[model samples]
Structure formats: structure tokens, C-alpha cells
Target: MFAPFRPIIKDPALRLAAVLLVLFGAHAATMAPYVSALAIRVFGLSDSAYSAVLLVASVLSVSASVGLGILADQRANRRAIALGTSAMLIAGSGLVLAGDNAVVFVIANALILPLSASIFGQLFALSRLAASTHPERDRPAILSTLRALFALPWLMVLPIWAVVFDHGAPLTAIYPVTLTLGILIVALTLAFWPRDGATRWPDPKSGLTFRQSLREMANLPILSRVVALGTINGAVMLYLVVMGLVFAATPGRGASDTALYAGLLAGLEVPFMLALPVLVGRVSRTSLIWVGAALYALHLGLLPLLAPTPFVWLLTIPGAAGGAVVLTQPMAYLQDLLSNRPGAGASLMALQKLAGDAFSAAVFAIGTALAGYELAAAAGALLGVIGAGALWAMDRRAARS
Candidate 1:
């Protein structure tokens, strides 16, 4: 399991890239468990309002990510882009900290969250560049190992966050920590990001329009299938939104419980991620996706029945297994499809986000209104089943072709 990781880390530049990715993951863990709670408790927004904010943020973030991705592909200085974007993200957080009212808070989040969200795409692009340079290393394994590293910070931080939240600490406490991590990420990128010669750029004489780019991507069967599966998987976001709301509304549970559940799920994912080097050779990527999708369906289906109790959260262990495959495989698959066109990776990322965010917003609005969180989760599970079937079909199609 560790064999794949050893070779990649032996190279200094690759090692720093991996460390930066871990810091990025840590930053995400610190915020994810509490963003909704912060909006509600600190900014005094309702659940629906917070969801709306997220929806908007997702849209804006996709745009920023795609734009930045194009710039990254055409230029070799990914470190500079990462550094600048990370600073903008920190600024956004600072604005939120200073906001005195809901309007100010919303504006601050709108500005920062989208930019911050795009950071993942940037990191993915960087990872692809790193892998491309080291042809001897297993690309999928390297990406998977990076993803496994991501789980560590979540595993560590979530429990600490639980402690902080349980002790009646202010939700705002998370911001400063995120700010510090952002600073560190910038520092790492500046210090160790590889600087190859300037990357190839599209001809200005006949530049690729966004429309042309979409058409090109749409023509690829595998790419289209991956995007479709990812869109359907967006239902998972609905489940997440509902879970956060459920935790907030539960009689005895609060931030600490939410953090614990998320931490447990993330912890469970670590082993699976670490095992990816072995698993990648044994299982087809599409098959792994199929198994993952099935697990997602099971996890969501069980949530309504088991939530608000410790037993329900255990489902996250399996859920994490599913998540590990879903999250890591799609990315690796996308990277494979767009290996020669790194900018396209950004487009694919943006497209998936657009689909997921749109579907999630619709599901949250319709499902929550028709019944409640449980009903919404069930609907999400249904989507997971559909997504799973789609992956199976894609596998069959690929095998036949």
C-alpha cells in the first residue's frame, strides 16, 4: 500500500506538492463541519437561507475555477496562481470576520467561498503536472495517496474541533486557524512549486471559445459518462445539507456530535484510500465507482432510519468507503481523459460542480418543502442508485467497445 507513495515522495518537488495538498485538505476539514453552523449561529441565517448561499457560492466558484484552470494550463506558474487565490480566500475570510450584519456576512462569503472552492481544481491541475513529469510513478496511486493524506488532517482536526465546540467555544474560532493554514499553503507553493518552462498556449488567432470547449468535451463518450455519473452523485450534497440541518435541529446533538460523525466517516476512508495502490491494479476504475455508488445509496437510505443516534453515524464508515471511491476515482478518471489538456480538467471540474450544485439546490428546495430532511435523504439515495446503474452501464459500454 505504501509502495506507491514512497517513490513519489522521494522527489523533493513532488513531496512538497503532496504536503501542500494535505494542508489544503486540512483547511477544508476545518471549515466543512462548521460552515453551516457558522452561518446559522454567527450570521443568524435559516437553513434554507444558508443553502441558498451555498448554491450561489457553488456557481461562482465554478466560474472562478474554470477561468483559473485555463490560466494554469497555458502558463507553468501554478504556484503563483495558487498563492494568489489562497490570499484572496484569506481576504474573504477576513471580511466575514469583520462583518457586523447578515448582508455583510453574505457578501463576504459570496466573494471568498467561490474563490476558495476553485482551489481544489488548481490543486488537481498541479497534481496532474507533477504526475506527468514523473512517468515512472503510478499516477492513479499517487493521486489516491494524496487523497489519503487528505483524510489525516480531517481525522485529526475534526476531533479537535469537537473538543472546541463542546467547550462552548465560538464558531469564529475556526476562521483564524483557516487563515493560518491559508498562509502556510501560500508559503509552500511559493517555496517549492515546480517551475518548468512556460506552458503551451492556445493560438490567439483561432482561440477556443467556451462554447467550442464544451462541444469538444461533449463529443467524448467517457468524459460525458463521467460527468453524468458525477451529476447524479450530486444528490450526495443534498444528503450532506440535510445531515447538517438534522444535526443542528436534534435535541441533544450539536456541533460536537456533527464533528464526531464527520471525523469518524473521514477516518474510515483513510484505510481504503491507503489501499488504492493495490486496489487500482485489481479492480477496474469503473467497477470501483459502481461499488462506491452502491454504498452511497445504502448510506443515504439508512440515514433517515438511523440518524440522531450513535448507531446511524456508524453507517458513515461504509459511506466513507463509498466516498473514497466516488471522490477519488472520478477525479483520476477526469485527469486521464484530460491529461494532455490540463485546462480541460478545470472545465470538467466546473461542469461537475455546476451540475451538482444545480441538482442539490433543486432537491433541497423541493424535497424539504414536500416532506423534510428524511424525505430529502431518501430522494438522494434514489439518485445514488440511478448514478450506480449509470456507472455499471458505462462499464458495460466500455468493455464492449
Candidate 2:
């Protein structure tokens, strides 16, 4: 069952992609979970402040990531990955040094988040590069592995922080280590990632005179729908994540409970990602998506009854299964589109990121303003319904066309 990963690494291009993915995961863990966890625990920030960080980071990161994507379109993957990773190393180092200054810390974190969006750079660049060297079905398998690799860092590193660092000491002390890791990642990416190659995809002219690639991507009909679906799903996903924490951290329940529930949801996702392709082969993508959507709806509806108990934890399983469906199938569909038009893949992927980021920020902002966790869950449920409707429409349209 798990043996395919062995062959995945033997293909040099895919292996390179997977390695870059792992490094990206390491970089992302620092900016995302590590930093946000620090802000919440050490700074004694309210849920609103933490939500704002995610929202602000999403906007800036998406904007920066799209710009980097255009640079990728015009240059070699190695140059793009090198430049982005270098930015992360600098930002990570800055975070390490700027420890006590709150303002500086936030600024550094914001900068660090966007730099980590370079992971998106690596994902898009390598996905395109891998497609050039391998068959189309390998794209989903590669993407699933790419996503699954992220779980290892979170599972391994995050719990360590939980165990060792009580308030935010671990985040502060570990900054230097993260910085060192950042430098190593940059060097490895620069050294081992594939460089200039035969025209696997058409290259646009260099020295872009300043036009938004996202606008161009949004203009494409298929890509536009994909971005729309992606945005809605992303927003709902963020709302679910944020509310779950809030519910777990309520007066009766503390941060430990929050952490436990969050960890459970996360743990389930990794294996789900690893197993996704096999499941995809056995079931239609449309069926998987609708089932996932329905499960999310059920999960959200149950939030009013949710409490900090092991029994409540079972609710997360269906939602987690739904999340796996949401996360994997869309990319597979998008990759198919990209295979038909390679030159557009990177930009389209970037647009999907931008749309998701923008909507996620909006959801976080709105949900944070609302006082009740139930309200947030209700909002998420609505978005899930909309996502399911869109998928249903698309599935019907595809059948007819």
C-alpha cells in the first residue's frame, strides 16, 4: 500500500520536488504554526489578534507569492527557488534576533510568512518541472506526496515545541535553529534543484514591464472557476480551523484541549494525504467531494454541542476526511488543466493561491469579529454548501460537455 513512495523518489525530478517540499515544510512550520503559536501564548494575544495575523499574512503572502510566480514564469526554477529561499533565510534570521520587540516581531513575522510562501514557489515550479519529465497521473501522486511531506515536520517539530516550550520560550530559543535550517534549505535547493531545461513549457519574455499575471490567470474561464472554488473552500477551511481552536480554548476548556483537538485533526490529515491517490482511483472525484462537503456540514452543525472531550474528537474524523477530499481533488483537476497548457500552470496555481489567500483573510476577519464559535461554524457550513454546489455544477457540466 505504501510502496509507491519508493518508486516516486527513484524518479530524479520527482525526488527533487519532494526534497524541496520537505524543506518548504520546515520553513513553513516556523512562520505559520510556530510564530502564530508564539503570538497566542507568549504575547497573551486574544483570538482576534491571532486571527488578524493569519489574515494579514495571507494578503501579503499571496501578493508576494504571485509576484514570485511571474518571476518563475520568466526564469529557471532554480533561480526562483534560490531567490525565495534566500529571502526566507534573511527573514528567519531577523526573527531570531528581534526577540522582545513586539512591533518588530510582528513585522518580522509578516515578512517571514511571505518568504515562506516561497514554498508555493517550489510547489508550482517543481510540479511543472515534474510534469515535463513524467506522465500526467504522476502529477496527483506527486502532489499528494508533496502535501503529505508537510505533515512530518508539523507532527515531529510542533509537538516538540509543545513539550519543551511552555509559554513561548521554545519558539524564541528555536529561532536560531530555524534560521540555520533556513540557510541549509536555501543551499540545498540552489544546489540540487533542476536548472535550465529544454522548453518543457513556453517561457514568457524576461524583464516583465509590470503586468499582473494574476489578472491574466483570472481571465481564463477554466482557471477562473477553479480559483473561485478554491477561494470559497479555503475560507471555509480557515474558519473551521480558527473556530476549532476557539471552542477548545473556551473557559471550561483550556489551550491544552485546543492543542489536542488540533493535533488530532492534523494527524489524521497526513495519512489521508498519503492514501488519497489510491482512494481517488477507487472513487469518482465528484463523489468524494460531495461526501466531504456533506461531512463538513455535519461537523459544523455539531459545533454547538462540541466540548473538550475525547468523544467530541470523533467529529473531527469526518471533517478531516472531507478536508482531504477538498485539498487533493482540486489540485488534481487543476493539474490536468495545466498539462493541456503548461505555460499557464504556474500562473494559474499562483492565482489559485491568491484567491484562496484573499478569501481566507476575509473569513478570518469576519469570523474574529463575531463573538460566538457557533456563528463561525455556521458561516463555514454555508461556504461548504456553496463549494458542494459549485462542484455539483461542474460535475454535471463536465458530463454534458
Best by lDDT: 1
RMSD of 2: 3.8
Predicted candidate 1 versus true structure: per-residue lDDT over 1-401, tens digit per residue: 77767856786656876787788888878887677667777789976787789788878877787667666555545667777787765776677667656887788676666787766777767666667656544777777888788777878888999999899998788878887888888777777765545433221211466666556666767566655666555766665566656777777877887788778888888888877667786888777877887787778777766776778877887788887887778777776676676667755777677777777777777777898777777777777667667767877887899
Compute the lDDT of residue 279 as modeled in candidate 1: 78
List the pairs of residues colliding in candidate 1: none
Model 2 has how many clashing residue pairs?
Answer: 0
**Model 1: residue 366 alpha-carbon error in angstroms:** 1.6
* Model 2 Cα lDDT, one tens digit per residue, 1-401: 46547645776666766676666666554444445446666666666666666667666766665566566555644455455655666575666476665666667666564556646545655666665556666656667776677655655554555555446453566567667777776776667655655434444444443365445555655665676466546644454455435553555654444444555555676788778888877887767777776776666556555664546678768766766666666656665564533334544554565666556556656765775555656665667567667766776777889
TM-scores for all candidates? 0.91, 0.81
Candidate no. 2 TM-score: 0.81
Write down the lDDT that model 2 would get: 0.60
